[model samples]
Target: MLIVTPVTPVTPTKTNFEFEIMNQNIVKALAGIMEKPGTTKRDTLAISRRVTRYICQQRRHLLTERHALRRKARKLRQYLPFTALAVADLEQQASDHNAELLEAYRRVLAAYGRSIIHDEEGIAAALGFDQLAALLNINPVHHEQAKREGGETLQGLVFVARMEDSASGFADEWGAGGPLFEACMAGLADFIRTCPDHLLPDPFAPGEVFGPKLPPQLRMV
Candidate 1:
């Protein structure tokens, strides 16, 4: 007679790593639930909460990175207006300044990378969907035209969705109400926690809002 030993699974130490795997699991579970809608609210919420916690952890990681990138992107945005103005007011040196501005824009894109694969709006643009990008209010055709014309009229150059959108997106999904909503909303709250005081939007004056309204929370920046 022979005996067999069970293998022990290894768990990731870093929360991000754990969440990354958990995200896949949650997506699969959601798909399974979609196939058979008889899942109890308690079970659904339990799964949603787990997914939400994972999302919160991922958002925290992005938030930390966002602080640095936001400043860099903002600076790029500021330069675009200035460069455009220089082109308009001081035509001769416009070519040189435009080159510099283009370089700065490249840097911002390189820094942002394709990490936002989960977000459809971002992924589409990141994958070079110029028309879709225009529709998404990210790198709109008018902005491109303005860039080509060297004009400073386009005010909303830098677009980043507010933290609230991410949670709301998941909550707003059909057949994902109740506990799922609470879970997603909770995830957004966690994202807010990672934000610095400066990043936090003021109640009196909100930040730039772009992307799908129906999805609720799905930002592309």
Candidate 2:
């Protein structure tokens, strides 16, 4: 027989890490929910109707929260246009299936969860490698129109989230961010803290970072 001591699991220091993972799960679950209805399977129209009301209600609540945050000088959510963007994507999806209403609501939810993702290759070229790699890891790159050129141009909008860095005395300002958005700052900090060397953006090795800055022949967007 052997005596054993209990070992404690390390708590995730960064909150957004958990937040993003949860949100991804939510997205997957929503897809499943929409595809199959309860009791009597929701016909496409019925599902569309249900989702529409759900989004409208969520939008109102979000608007209220935005107002309160603005009033209190807290960081206002900059995702108002997000829903609009999703609307555009969902419209395409709807057009594919001819589900007008369903597309609209899908757009709303999609925008509800839009963010950017960029590696440090460019930012390192401008700022430095260390800072770029420090950004939080969130969403993937958005492929609207595959660019034939200018690889450095960011195809993602990384969420420039609020940082809890005591040393970073910056205010929580919300709005558009540069193309160099790599990840949520909170996650970035965690990445740097835990895995400083095992990440991307090894700019000193350019070929490894962004593939030798694409040839001039490719027309970039």
Candidate 3:
């Protein structure tokens, strides 16, 4: 009697590339918030909240889809004798889908980071943040590192912005309404009003550094 052995599919694991992709996505998202259409503090805050909510919604949807695919693949694998090929195919699809989602996320983060670094630097400088930082002895080494490495520094800014916009009264406690804050708001408003074109550059533009490298079917619509 000849016996056939069932082949076990290798479990999908995250690679360094996936981590890099996620990091890029986060930076681009922060840049997006800074580039939103808002001049005054109120307007900028509102726009940032809305955009952040939208990004969260999209991420949740992608996660749900990926989870469902993975679950289905696992179920299919149980019927190994009959479903080996199908299970493997399903696993591959799930992996590809995840990669696509990561790529989409990365594009957003890179775009947002570039917008802040290239488009909004002038606004920050004009608002006297540079001088204020100098006076407060705040080292901008993290900011410089974010510009160079596109890492967690950008994500940290997003967290700060969220906290500032929260209703916990933290902003008030931190003197968020001070002269420097007002100047920052006013400068942002002026930048938005004057250079609307530069705020949200297309991250998926052809030949762009962060453009979509995935196939059309795999890319997020």
Q: Write the per-residue lDDT of candidate 3 for residues 1-221, one digit (tens) a residue.
A: 32335534333457956865675577466556656665543334334334434454555556676777678778767677677776677677666765776556444434433443343434334434333233322336534432332222212222222122233333445534222222233334445556768575564575332354344456666
| Number of colliding residue pairs in each model | 3, 7, 12
Tell me how far the alpha carbon of residue 17 in candidate 2 is from the true structure, in angstroms, after superposition.
Answer: 15
lDDT of each: 0.37, 0.34, 0.45
For 12-118, candidate 1 gives per-residue lDDT tens digits of 36985776667667756764773465765334323433444444444444444434434443444445654443323333333233345344333322222221212
Model 3: lDDT equals 0.45
Q: Is candidate 2 or 3 superior in lDDT? A: 3
Which pairs, if any, clash in model 2? 86-107, 116-157, 116-158, 134-188, 135-188, 136-183, 136-188
Task: Tell me the tens digit of each residue's lDDT in model 2 across 40-143.
Answer: 22232233233433555444444454444333222212243434444344333323332343345445434322222242323324533223223322122311
In model 1, which runs have C-alpha deviations exceeding 4 angstroms?
Answer: 1-22, 71-221
Which prediction has more favorable TM-score, 1 or 3?
3
lDDT of 1: 0.37
lDDT of 2: 0.34
RMSD of each: 23.9, 22.1, 17.6
